[model samples]
Target: MIKRRLNVLLIEDHFIEIMKFKKTVSFAEIQHSITEAKDGAEAFKILEDKSRMPDLILLDLNMPKMSGVEFLSILKNSEELRHIPTVILTTSDNQKDLEECYRLGISGYILKPLKYKDYATKIEAVLNYWSLNELKKY
Candidate 1:
């Protein structure tokens, strides 16, 4: 088993999907930690903590209290968490959502109900291809 190195934050409300994702993105090989928050409010708390701050965040667009868009807006506007890259991991395929996310400066987005067969590969690609410095200039 690969030891978790990076602490990944997942801000998804769906319990089943979250559980599935946790299992799919294994500690083996990938070697990254996983943290889940049911809502944007909780995610904000995680981001607020300098120690709990994750290298990456997997966010969902539709949620209770604070939506992904709302959270992104706040984070982008916050001096402390603005630099952290957040990837929208939602089922919304709407162009508007996509456009808004890009405008808000998200690192990337991944659709859910992920096929077990290809989920790991896609995640690996996302993690492997992720570049914080390149994202800053965008």
Candidate 2:
């Protein structure tokens, strides 16, 4: 299967986590465009530009300014943004958080694994699936 190069928006707060994700992508040798946002507020600013919207969003539940749930709520409510596929990439294994994310119409929810290899594998699978799957273009 031909792997499509995806435009991805990664909404995360921790600098180390961000670097880890970038390193994974680089190590995996996946040619993808990744946009980073420190928090929901920053993500919102980036999302405002419809012309440059990402194909997929990887959101972290814990963030400053606005939590992932809060961000998801607003995004899901917006007709213009609701269709974009958002997958939660979080360490929280709380059932409530998982249920809430699904209730808010998240595309997928994945817990960050402790091991770097495990994390990389999960990320690779996610990117592969989304890249191969058909997405709605607005």
Candidate 3:
């Protein structure tokens, strides 16, 4: 368990996927506050408010408004927001997507697991690791 509660921004389009992620996180036993965004545009709007800035961002590659890559480009270029750790949490196994995300300065890229159990396990590990890792908050 984390010593402190983390504020996480989850940008995903699919409602079912969002719910699954929330469920998985809940079972992980990690203390966190998750703010959901349907798309990158909404996520960016939330980020505009410095007080609401998230400790981490879980981004999906495909979405209706402003894809994940576009969001990452903007976030990485921003002096104020660049320090926040952004991880790609998507179903896309595209090699190009992986390379582009890394090039754009993503902290990590993870392929979404197919099974619910696997998803929960992967999320638990990720949350545990991040909770231990040091981050530079802006």
Best by TM-score: 2
Candidates' lDDT values, in order? Answer: 0.78, 0.94, 0.88
Q: Write the per-residue lDDT of candidate 2 for residues 1-138, one digit (tens) a residue.
A: 777888999999999999999998886556889999999999999999988899999999999999999999999999999999999999999999999999999999999999999999999999989999888776
Residue-pair clashes, model 2: 0
Clashing pairs in 2: none
Lowest-sum lDDT 10-residue window in model 1 = 129-138
TM-score of each: 0.84, 0.97, 0.94
lDDT of 1 by residue, 1-138 (tens): 223355689888988878777776664455567889999999887776787777778888999998899999999998878888888988899999999999999989887645765765666666655522243321
Model 3 agreement with the true structure over 64-127: per-residue lDDT tens digits: 9799999999999999998899999999999999999999999999889899888888887777
lDDT, candidate 1, residue 136? 32
TM-score of 3: 0.94
Stretches of model 2 off by over 4 angstroms after superposition? none
Against the true structure, what is every candidate's RMSD?
Answer: 4.1, 0.9, 1.4
Give the Å error, residue 73, model 1. Answer: 0.3
Ranking by TM-score: 2, 3, 1
Model 2, TM vs. native: 0.97
